[model samples]
Target: MSNKVTKFFGSPWGQRVSLLIIVILVMILFQPKFFSLDNVSSILLAIAIYGIMVCGMLFVVIIGGIDLSIASAAALGGSILSIFAKGSGYTVEGFITGFVVAIVVAILVGLIHGVMCTIFGLPAFVVTLATQYVLLGAVLVVTNGAYIYHSDFGVFYMLGNARPLGIPLPIIIFLIYTAISAFVLGCTTYGRSLYCIGGNPVASGLVGIKTKINTIIAYIFCSVSAFFGGMILVSMNMMAGAATASNAIGSVLTAIIVGGINLAGGEGGIPGAIFGALLVGIINNALILLGVPSDYQKFVQGVIIIGAIALNVYTSRRSENMKTPLKPSKKTLDSAQSAKL
Candidate 1:
């Protein structure tokens, strides 16, 4: 019984179970009322939006790339959507047109990153960092540092705020994307190749993998996902502002890290990413529920992110050590030699 218990606790799912239990205990002690259906739905709604962005980050990280431009790309996409929706006149046709244009802009940004990384042999970090600045500058230029409002698109607002059968659309969209991402990462050859490339680019290339193309595809996925996240943000707020969207960077990175994804890549999954986002969302909601001051929230978030990353590193190292071969006893070695003789 003890061995069984130990084995169970040693499993990944078991660790998750333990974490969930701890979370439940903390909530029960700190804010027992948070377990309500309404609160749960609200948390899900928040997670849905950020979770989508985290999913994109997961793709980038899995392919051993980082996208510093995701936040700005999202901002740009949302801004474009708002700009076109207002300037092209008010109609369903205009809304569709604007939405398509916004998505195209995001894809183009992603293509630039891909080309820069693959063709020019630029590091993804450098490429994305530069693109981040470009995107921020573009947003400022396009909107002239003003918020773009789309008061005419009432139906579009439903994408972010409306609930159908008590389920938020964003949450639905999140689940759909999560499902697709999980499938792609788990069941597809492309997904397997991402792991291979991240694990060892040289080996992957030697094995006939199109490493460059795969890396490019991964960045495109990240940018497109960020674009979708921006669309949701615009739909929710009914406005897009150049300066404000920058605030999401810390939270997005926190989610990706807390979800147990290594910054170095080749290890982590969508479930881990989702759990990380949920953990952050819950922590924030709990703070609000406890009536914590808004000014102190940033400090608390920073502390939590640090703690999560530290824990992830410790556990990952421990797991790696556990997988190493145990040293053979002298008696065992002698027995093996005698048997061979």
Candidate 2:
């Protein structure tokens, strides 16, 4: 029983459980009425969209890769979908086409990043930074710096706005994605290879792991998740623009870091990312409810991210320095007795 208790509280899930308690306490203290079912449902709904991206980003980060292009890719996806839907008059087929095209475009962007990094030997940071600019420019060019609004797409709006079986569709989708990601990352051989690659790419290659393929797949997953997140944003707002959802990249990074994922990679999991998103979302909502200025919010987020990163580094170093005492062997004991004699 004692061992089980220690393990439970020592795990990532335990930390998240503590965070949830803190969140609840803060919410109750600041706004006692925030405990209503409606607000709780709304919070869950909001988490659904960002949570999906968080899961994918966790995977990418675990592989020692990063994707700053996520926000722009999301904007691009939303903008393209809105524009195409507006031009095509909001038919079911048009919606399908637009959605498919957006996802495909995002995946291609991921492919570009992966191929460039692998083929040209560029750093993931530099590659993703350049891709971010390109994606932003593409969104601006495609949308012509305009917002596309299509109110006639009742189906899309409903998917975003309505709850079925007492649960939001976005939440349901996020849950499904989370389940699949957990399965892939935790239970599959490929997932284990990803961790090995992140730990030591050269060593993993020497050991016959296809490091390149796994890295590419990780980026692909990141892009796909961002694309879906963008779709959700568009559906929720019934509009899309180049500047819409600009704050997500930083927010997502902050969440991932806070969720206990190491920036250097090879650690953290989907559950950590989920909890990080939840904590971030709850904090943001609380700030808004308290009427804090937008600038201050950004400042707080920056501070939180920096602090989390610092903590992660410190903890990692400490863990590395920790040494387990070795048991004495019979040969060593005999040698010690002979020295005493």
Candidate 3:
């Protein structure tokens, strides 16, 4: 029984599961209300937006890239949708038009990142960081540096706020989005190729994996996911502005890191990313429930991030060490020599 317990906890999935269980037990002991249906729903609702973004970000991260511009990209998406929809009196046609336009722009931005990274050999961090400014500037320009407040509460409002069968729309969207992402990553040839490319792009291309094109597609998907989440966010708030999802970069990246997805790339999955998002959400919720001051919350979060990163590195090293073969025993070596004689 002890051996079985140790074996279970040694596996990567088992470790994560154990960590989750421990967190839940702590929450139950300290704040029993954490299990209340309303609080659980609230936590899910809050994490759903970032969870959606994490799905898209997983693709790029798998291929060993980062998209620092996602927050700005989301802001741009919301700003575009609100501007066009408001200009058209909140008509259905206007909403569709804005949605389509926002998607197209997102695709273009993603394509730009892909080209600059794959063709020009620029680092994704540099490209995305520069474009982050460009996207934020575009948001400011499009929204005229003012917050867009939606008063009509039409289809646009329902897109984010509506509850179906007692489930929030964002949660449903998140689940569906995660399902699709997981299927593609876990089942498809393209997904497998992404792992290969992330691990060793030169070898992947030598094997006719079309690494550049695949990377480009991954970037596009990431941008579109960010846009989709941004639209939902603005609808929920009934407002859009340059500040929309401003803190998302940190939240999304942090979730990815905490979930055991290596920032260096070629190692992670949808389940881990989602678990990370959920864990972060629960921790933040716990902070609120515990009445931790807002100022202290940020400090606590920073410390948590550092601790999580250290733990991640330690676990990775341990796993790698376990893979190393032991030296041959002296008796086995002597027997082999006697057999040869």
Candidate 2 deviant stretches above 4 angstroms? 1-15, 313-341
Candidate 1 colliding pairs? none
Q: Can you tell me which runs of candidate 3 are displaced by over 4 Å?
A: 293-298, 319-341
RMSD of 1: 4.8
Q: Candidate 3 on 1-341: residue-level lDDT in tens?
A: 99989989887767778878888899999998999999998899879998999999999999999999999999999999998899999999999999999999999999999999999999999999999999999999998899999997788988898999978999999999999999999999999999998999999999999999999999999999999999999988899999899878877887897788888888999989999898878877888888996556556667767887887778777876775567555567899999999
lDDT of 1 by residue, 1-341 (tens): 99999888776557756776787788888887899988888788778888998998898898788899888888988887777767767566667887888878877888888889888989989999999999999989999988887676465777788888877889989999999999999999999999998899889999999988988888888898888888888888788977545645666787787676877878789998998788777776777888998667678768877887777677767876775568565577899999999
Sorted on lDDT, best first, the list reads 3, 2, 1
User: How far out, in Å, is residue 290 in model 3?
Assistant: 2.7
How many residue-pair clashes does candidate 2 contain? Answer: 0
Off by over 4 Å in 1: 10-13, 293-298, 316-341
lDDT of 1: 0.82
Error of 3 at 229 (Å): 0.6
Q: Which clashing pairs does model 3 show?
A: none
